[model samples]
Target: MNREILVENLIEFLPILYKKFFKGLDVCEITKQQFELLYCVGQWDEKPMTYYCSKMLVSKSNLSIIADRLIEEGFLERNTLPEDRRVILLRLSEKGRGFLCDQTNKFKKEIINKLEKFDENDIKRLNEIMQEAREIVTKLD
Candidate 1:
């Protein structure tokens, strides 16, 4: 494959590798696809169930199944808006909030500390790579 394609592939694969290795996480728990869906949904500040399927690029049935598991696990909740009963809102539960807070902090700090073992130039190069990816993605949007 070409350099650009290899870069794209690595960009997508690295997070999965890190999650598996460092987090001691198994993709089969949520399944990798569901995990991606949940991550995208969780990133949203305002979540409407109606829009989640389209936004996450998940099928209606699959979204419903994921939602059902999330609800059952007490990681997500469905609520009716007072202004409109037809409008359903999705928000993280207390368990979800605490879990994410702890996990994200631990993950981020671990990455930082691990990468810190490298010298200044290596760190600078890492930051440059991240910035380049961000710029490319932002420009595409």
Candidate 2:
């Protein structure tokens, strides 16, 4: 496929996939942006605010606002680098980890419910296809 066609297909497919299988699964009190920030922080250990700014494609000031809210809610904690007291790092608090875990399990259950019509063989094939797709997509990074 041509690059343009491939890009268009991805633009179409991604939202369809999310809406079908992942949308509304996060039945939490946080806003979508907050959830996204939590998800990004959950992926790694302590990271500086700058790291999150780049990863979330938000400005430093915006990222700080989200971080402050999460910190206030006890879902995240901020600590200054010991060596360079100026650099701030963020990490998930115990509550944040628990929330992320619960959210993940909820998503798994929802996905399983949606796949109930598929037989074992179909499910296995789907998993294989997804794994292959992930491997190929990761190469783009």
Candidate 3:
């Protein structure tokens, strides 16, 4: 297949996959944007709000609102850098970790249930393909 067609297929399929995994998801009580922010903090460790603004593609004001809400909800906390009081660091709290773990397990269970109909060979092939895709994506960084 042409690279353009392959890229197009990925673009098209990714949203379908996202919807399958995230649509109507109720494992967490947060909005999609909020969940994404939590996931980013959980995965990336301490980072500034600007970092998340870049990652989440939102304005500082918008992310601040999201961050404020998350902070209020006890999912995330901000710490002023001791060196520079102007710099703020964001990280997930224990509650946030628990929430992430619960949501992950829920997603895992849902995926496993969906995969039950597939044969072992098909599942193995899919795992191999997914790993290859992950490697390819990692190389883009």
Candidate 1: residue 5 Cα off by (Å)? 5.2
Please report the candidate that would top lDDT against the real structure: 2
Residue ranges of candidate 3 with Cα displaced over 4 Å: none
As a TM-score, model 3 comes out at 0.87
Q: What ranking of all candidate models by lDDT puts the best one first?
A: 2, 3, 1
Q: List model 1 lDDT by residue over 1-141, tens digit each.
A: 698998899899989757744665443344555555456557884477768877777777788788788778787788887888877677777776665566567667767776767899988997898899889878753
Q: After superposition, how far is residue 119 of candidate 3 from its true place, in Å?
A: 1.0
RMSD of 2: 1.8
Among all candidates shown, the one with the greatest TM-score: 2
Q: Estimate each model's TM-score.
A: 0.66, 0.87, 0.87
Backbone clashes, each candidate:
0, 0, 0
Candidates' C-alpha lDDT: 0.70, 0.90, 0.87
User: Residue 125 in candidate 2 has what lDDT?
Assistant: 100
Candidate 1 segments exceeding 4 Å error: 1-38, 81-87
How much does candidate 1 score in TM-score?
A: 0.66
lDDT per residue for candidate 3 within 7-28, as digits (tens), equals 8998999899878666666655
